[model samples]
Target: MDIDVNDSTPPAPEEYPDVDGEPPAWAEDRTPLGDAIPWFRKFQGGMHTKEGILYGLLISGDAGVRSYIDDEIIITRTGGSSERDAEGKLSQVADQKDDTAISRSVNNSMKFNIAVGVVIGKKNKILKRKLPHAFNVMDYFRVAYVWHERIDGFIAVRFRLEKLELEEKSWWAEKGSPAPPRTARRKWVKPIEHICGACAQTYYRIYMQGWMCLNTSCSQFWKLPDGNDPPVELDYDPKWLDWRHDPSDEVQPHYSLVPDFMSVIDDSDPNSTYSRTSWKNGIVCPSCKQCLSRRFWDGWRCDESCGFKRVLNMQTISLRAVVDDYEVAPIRRAIVFDPGPKETALIEPEIDDVYSHPYRRLVFDLPGAGTVTHFVTNREINAKPNGPNDLFIQLQQANLGLRRYPLSQAGMPYGFVVAVDSLPFSEACDPILRVMGRLTWATHEATDKQGVTALIPNELLALGYFEDMAINYHDDGEDTLGPTIASLSLGAMAHKSLRMKYKYYNGFTKGSKKLVHDDPVLEGCANRDWRLDLKQKLDNNELDWPAYEAEWWRTYKANKSGAAREAPPCIKTQLHHGDLVVMHGDGVQKYYEHQVELEKGGGAKLRYALTARHVLPAKIEPGQWPKGQFQLTKDQDYKGT
Candidate 1:
């Protein structure tokens, strides 16, 4: 359960914001909330636990946040195994009846920071009376509200470097000139005509336009345009479309947990809360200096990564182990780290600020360092022993390198504890493991314009096959999203529902037809409750979307700006190993209202293709924004949408 610092009083249903069970019809047009972006920017070593937040707002002029003496948070660095004061100066320690306290680090360096920035541990439920950061530091207490976790624990850096960056006043956004449009596309040459000498029998103009047989029966009857012998173009419009191609075998489900987000409900607090936000989101415009975005949990964020990223921490609740007797892996880690790159100037977004803009911006803009601290607490229910080791086994079972792991590493080398923000590979991950392979190989090597190698000879055949079956429909518009298109399974597979998606924007109002409450928006559509609403956001144009839903996107403005608050989606999930499921693109319930029904006990972890046709403009730098990754929010400084 989550505890909201804004409201001191613990809330019940009466105090809770009235959450509706349904959304409007036009909600379909809203973009699916940008998927979460993992946090791996930090160069965090091993550590757990976070202190209170100390915030200082950025005012005008030459004035700035003071150092530890003045405007700074004034944290006292007191370190020790059992010492609680700044400098770890405690002399004596008390014994506990049971294991009341965690095993403190014995190494002098492992001692906790003695200086006191602000103590925001769960012990004291708030970043209150502290430096006054934008967000409620206490929010990290509940598992529901923590950031993504790494397997053993979270990957976090020390506070010293983080403090250094804070004092540097380097908190700024980035800017860039848009790239020239990709023009000069290939001219779609037309097909040619061929005439027989005597019988005048026609034959396909294969020599001129290749064998695009318009009519199978008249294979040799090649049609002509006006008087042009070999037309550069041929009939391909919907009006003149024909032909069929066989598709490959259906790809199975590759489920993935919307990282950093374990569940909707916050079980820590009595409120039984739900965190609507996640880490697997997109890259925003030149925001933080660090181009921090990653997969899997890395220890620390890049130096330039934002400081006040809300890190949610929690352990997975194994359904199989209802009682404490069963072992439960309290943690399965996945982090979103910062990757330093675009830290020059402020580049504001060009779209409207929706949902809660000012608050989100402040929360996002807070200049500090990012960290991922993770630990486990055994809260045995009914006084039972939850299998810790066994629980850990379940957690790592589906990881990429699960097979190459050690259960009890008494003296084994720690596996590569990579920060997802860094490149994702064992020395070879960064460049080789890219969504788009090298644009070009070495000088001696060969590749296509797009950097494709000749080794994949089967690619041509696969493309032709997919295109053919894509349009080849025989059933009576059967109204089902069957013949599932290609699905790319990364690892943990799960979410495969026959749904469709149609995004809308700024289309929410009391009685708008698109806002119709809780009814099916489209004919034959099932599970239409996932519809989203962006009535608050201003439209963004930095990245010209290849396509849009309903073409109804309108200019918008920030209703307000304060603290960023994300309401978790009811459908977000984490995938398990060896799981496979299938869903079609047409009925995907992309934008419009949609419902998701689990197949009894068969509901496995959730999955997303991460294969949305999101294309970046040319201006995006290769070194900065990794391939297959983009931002959901507008940049840092733009004024209008």
Candidate 2:
């Protein structure tokens, strides 16, 4: 069909190929769509086929689609009044948004289509999506090109554009296997306007196409039409903005508890440290001492290091906690408190000294004044105020009350600031309580591979190492060698691996031994100021000098005996997820070597690893045992490998 999409009528380029004379190399053996396309003279050919064309086979999957084509209006169409319409009565009823009815019609045309097969109205929610590739759609009609779908349905189509057509298009859709009912042809509705109003400008209309501009400055806003309701707004004073949203002037940390010196944020969600005071304001992330500056993103910034960014504005609450009818929510008060109108630096209460503890004084600024808790003797929150012991009892009860929801949500009971409640500084221990419950061991051994088992230091406790004890597990009895360092867990688990390359070093040797004073092998080129290509790497730039030549020969003298025999080396691996393997205290790294390997299929689903290993500072002989990846040393003190 010679569709008039663009400028002028013209002959199809491939339909008139020079068979005798010689076809171009590209045109030789061209596929159906590829051969038909005239690529060389596109700007010229485009004059004729501005609107492209589409061809689709009536595969088994597409045969049934033609049945739903609406040649004319149906006989029994009705309106809301329940009055029936005959023949031409409902002829003008075209813009109804009911998707199912539209799907039943299966409307389409040769040039354009608006079929409501799957993505009916935009009301369908997508449970999941592939993001960048998710809503991928090809459309001839720009205004209606957006193909939204339900969680299950999908859409796909392809087209061939011609040069002659104005606003040219070429398209076709076919399924791989047989479909129940598919339509081939349907009426195409040409987009009369260049830009959809909702897209061109601001549109606040009840229903329309495209993502409308939400910015208030744009015109074309859809006014509240007849029989439509508007959003509700309450007359809140401007002061609430400072208290609820911006709290830089409100929160102050206690300086009484000496151990609690690190003045971190006190937001309920630690992950949400970047809860900015302003939602749309400009801000930037600053360099934080604790590397937590990026966490509190509030807004765009003129300069980075301001340490703020915005958090998502939405909050999710559990539904089952409320009444059956969720139409109304119980009265919950939100309060904004500013300790003083200071410009900046309102920190969570800190404790400078254990003796100067606030005692009963409210050290931290809480959202409400309802639940006053005391530290309980047990690991819980006590709400009663009889004494410090009473506080412990109250804390115990509080702990029992807080254990129901997902740990991510339940862990943060320093709930959003509410109008009437006073929570104290000791409440920092609230999270500490949860941490205590998770840690099974108060005292344990911290061992190094050198067979040195040091008492689990107080430093580990101060750094909150035991806070995640529930997750750190190892086995009862395990024998491990080098390559993978292995730790025997209290619960019968081994986290890392150790693969040892053993060579007997006896005091009595038959041959002349070299007592070299220095390592002859050159230092790694990485420290040298040179950029060499792959060629230089293969060249023997190392150990090629006369000095190294003698050193290398001496290193291998009389050292070949008693070396382990290599018979099918069935290597045992101990690679576990999130295992931290540390090289410690002794100067062993001064002699050993280490390297990391990226294993194929090592982690399929969620396995990601980062490694730090010991690289020998000393020279190793050529073709020595323990050469590559699994080389370890018998001496030297190098930590953090």
Top candidate on TM-score is: 1
Task: Mark the regions of model 1 whose C-alpha exceeds 4 Å error after superposition.
Answer: 1-131, 135-521, 525-641
Candidate 2: tens digits of C-alpha lDDT, residues 419-468: 12212223324423222221111111113212444332111111100111
Badly placed stretches (over 4 Å) of model 2 are 1-308, 312-550, 553-641
Q: Give the C-alpha miss distance for residue 318 in model 1, angstroms.
A: 17
By summed lDDT, the worst window of 10 consecutive residues in model 2 runs over: 458-467
How many clashes would you count in candidate 2? Answer: 116
Q: Write down the TM-score of every candidate.
A: 0.20, 0.17
- Put down candidate 1 lDDT per residue, 1-641, tens digits, no spaces: 23223346644423333211111100011111122212111122112223321111111111111112111222112121222245432222332111112112111112322211121211111111222212111110001000110111211111111121121221111113222222233122332444544345443333223333223234232333332333422222211111111112121111121223324424353112111122223222122312223221211132333443323233343333222222321222232333223321221221212322211111111011111001112222111221222322233232322111111111011112221222212322221122112111111011122243232100000000000011110111122212121112222223221211221222233233253222223322222222223211213342223322232223122333222222112122222221111222222333322222222222222211211111222333355334333222222111211
Candidate 1: minimum summed lDDT over ten consecutive residues — where? 458-467
Report lDDT (CA) for all predictions: 0.21, 0.21
Query: Backbone clashes in each candidate structure, one number apiece?
Result: 146, 116
